[model samples]
Target chain A: MRRTPPEKPADYLPIAFPAAMLGLFFVVPFAIMVAISFFERVQGGFYQPAFTLANYGRFLSAFFGEILVFSLFLAALVSAVCLVLGVPFTYLLTKLSRRVQVAWLIGLLGVLSLSEVIIGFAWSTLLSRTAGISNLFVALGLMQQPRAWTPGFAAVMTGLVYQAFPYTVLVLYPAFSRLDPSLGEAARTLGASPLRAFLTVIVPALRKTLIATFIIVFIFALGAYLLPQILGRPQHWTLSVLVTDQAIYQSNMPFAAAMAVFLVIASLVLVLLANMINRREPAS
Target chain B: MSGRFLSRVFFAALALFLALPLVVIAGVALNEKKTLAFPPQGLSADWYLQIFTDDAWRAALVHSVLIAASSALISVAIAAPLAWFLWRRVAPWARIVQVLGLSPFILPPVITALGALSFWATIGLYGQPWTVVISHGIFFVSLPLVTITLGFATIDREIIEAGTTMGADDRTLLKTIVFPLIRPYLISGFAFAFVLSLNEYIVAYMTIGFTLETIPIKIFNALRYGYTPTMASVSVFFVLVAVTVFGLVARFGDLPKLLGAWDEGER
Candidate 1:
């Protein structure tokens, strides 16, 4: 590698602004949150500075434990479903013409950038009795009546899957596009069926990418807050939803902070694991 | 051939599945009545018009735009120099700085939002609109950091060398050569953060709460009460904004490359 000239003292000046901003906003706040997580909850829904593991210990209780377990399960399920559907779809997408690919990319980006609030709202409407797909079934004589599907596990799953599908595709796009087409062709020449070729050859070859994508999607889905509230019953709420409810409605900032801290640590570990896997995957 | 036909059908079905909710929302926005109906009891643009005409909804729209525009600008401002420093220097701390800049985005927004929520509350800045702007600016800094880094990577080393050889100073080289090259990247970065910030809910809600009625907050508050065609209309409007911004990015920038596709030469 070519060596550039040495930096001057003034070169450090550019970094100072962002450093200050992030340090003040990001670092300080996280520190405060960690501190608050250990603080004591006082009367009247406020908290005071103190050392206590009570907030974290509450996570061991049935209610909080259930939410934590359910959050992880939902995230894992969403990730798996998205990868199963998205991997194939993205691979097929790469085979299309560039113009068509760009159009699809735009559509995906639009969906990906859209607010969760809007998507939850849209799905709620789509799953409602008046505007839902069940109405179409009723119109075609396939059903006797329209049906409202919100406030259920299936509805929450559908909303989250829809929200996560775009991200899954976007995350997997580069890997799928970069895949050497001749590998599949070679498999085909060996008398392997197409499905067999995909199963045996392509899937294994991209295992690391697939794993990384799964973890990324998992982290995203685990943090879903609005969809559960809008589409599911209170019993189906995720940790994120509970965190918000605790802080805002229940006015328990200490517990909310503890949950948030746990979420951050969990995400960081998964991210590190993904990084290790990617680093070890002999750079293609 | 049978397998190929099956794959095509599968792709078409998935596309329809992806589009179903969006199509439903659009249909519902056109309903004449207040009730949410897909096939439309009647047709009217009144709800769409009401987004701008209604006081609460209009205020929310203005607040969303304000937060998005200012936060995007702040993001680019912070991201540009940080990316430049990383590109220009080869120091160990540069990597750490990059990680710090990117960490807010990589972690769940809820964690970052909670942190910001507490941070602001501690400093007595809670519920302030500018807190939302600054928090989002820092949180979404990774967008521009990635794009601008990509921008710097695309800059030819020889061009900078030539400028230096021709007696141009560091300032001149940056102003003439580097700045012009990265302009598109900066704009795309701004656009990406703008659209996302405009549509963001959790962070905005956590930081500013209901004090500033961003479109997402307004919609959520409204939903807790009941359904409104106006909410659907705003959603449709959001989709249009997102699509338009991304379409422009695709047209003006190398969309595939920005999206992580390997370069044509590399392939």
Candidate 2:
């Protein structure tokens, strides 16, 4: 009687309200995606209900697997680069006066709120094949137009870094702010250099934020489509791009569905593993 | 450390990185020549005129606005009730309900898009803008739910106790005190959801099936064919709308906190 509450319509109504609506929207959509992957396309591009593993087998294909590998490697690289770039910037922001902190926060917020597509478009112009920033580089004898900057792996990496950098900085800022000012002061008083104190004291304390920021950044970067699709070499496509290419350009819905499934699996595995490791250790 | 010197250099670099792209885009938009060249042949907002005149581009902008506005409303309405339930119920299932709300944000959008596309296709709900709104809405529902949850926690429990002592039931208390106070959080949540939905491309592009294009689809198409003067203008337009919308939200809401700030107590 203590364990279970009296049955009343009002008691469960609130919890049940969202459960039903959420079921209709989120779970059902995922089910359809999975179900469609196993079906064949009929005449006129309509989905035909037929059980098949042909779609799932495409994941083993060299072409699809290659793109997935490239994306994973690139995503990992960008995540690292974002952390490297973000930590210092976040440190700088935290050290600022309150008004300055607010100002700096505004800038970070602006970038965070800016869409992935906007960043992609802007970066493309700045590094366009011809008659753009790369062209300016050529005119100044810096590099040539139709430069190796855009439409390649390097460009995609750059864009992903730019997109994820703000999140990294924002996440790291709090960790940095939470640092004890007097610890660094005491270290300096005891003859430790600023850099040494930072490396020993500040860095260790930031481990949790570092992990959290990295996971969140990785999640966003890995799933990101626009930056890679625009800037990446078609041959060096991200899984997100591959999924879109298959679904939209090739009209290979089955193959696309397969790619989307693999993408989610990759993300889920990483998130679960990170959480497990974090829970076990408590901190790095 | 030469703190001031290092800070200045870092900040200047950041500002340039943030500003240069927009400056280049805006400059190219004004180029009298057809190509998107900087140090333009001449300056004019002719490209802006071209943006307004382009039927496909204009259609996409309209679609983006409509989808964003409607989705924000829908997400907020549903998330509010769900959050209220979770806060009041405190049952075992309430935790599951919160996770359900947040799961979409954690899950890859591509996977979500795929599922949504398939789901809609099977139901023959494809090509309808409402489908896009609902699909994005479910994902964005988490935003309002989070805000309202935080607001609920922040409210002075004693004030609500006082209200209850004054003969307020849950419904009356919600109307008299809870709703009025958390209104800012609610508004901010709506704005964030609306802005993000407007700017979203991958989901919009995949689910819309080429029958309807958003501003992002137009910019994407423009990139594929060529980066025309007009498209540069479109980029400028996007930046402006993004800046204004984001500026308003940051002004009214805890933008950094939403980005997962750690030192909110100090701020």
DockQ of each: 0.71, 0.50
Least accurate stretch of 10 residues (summed lDDT) in model 2 chain A?
A1-10
TM-score for each model: 0.97, 0.91
Candidate 2: Cα lDDT at A21: 74
Error of 1 at B150 (Å): 1.2
Q: Report the Cα lDDT for residue B205, model 2.
A: 72
Report fnat, model 1.
Answer: 0.73
In model 1 chain A, the worst 10-residue window by lDDT is A1-10
What is the TM-score of candidate 2?
0.91
Candidate 1: where are CA atoms >4 Å away?
A1-7
lDDT of 2 at B243: 65
- What local lDDT score does residue B126 receive in model 1, on the 0 to 100 scale? 92
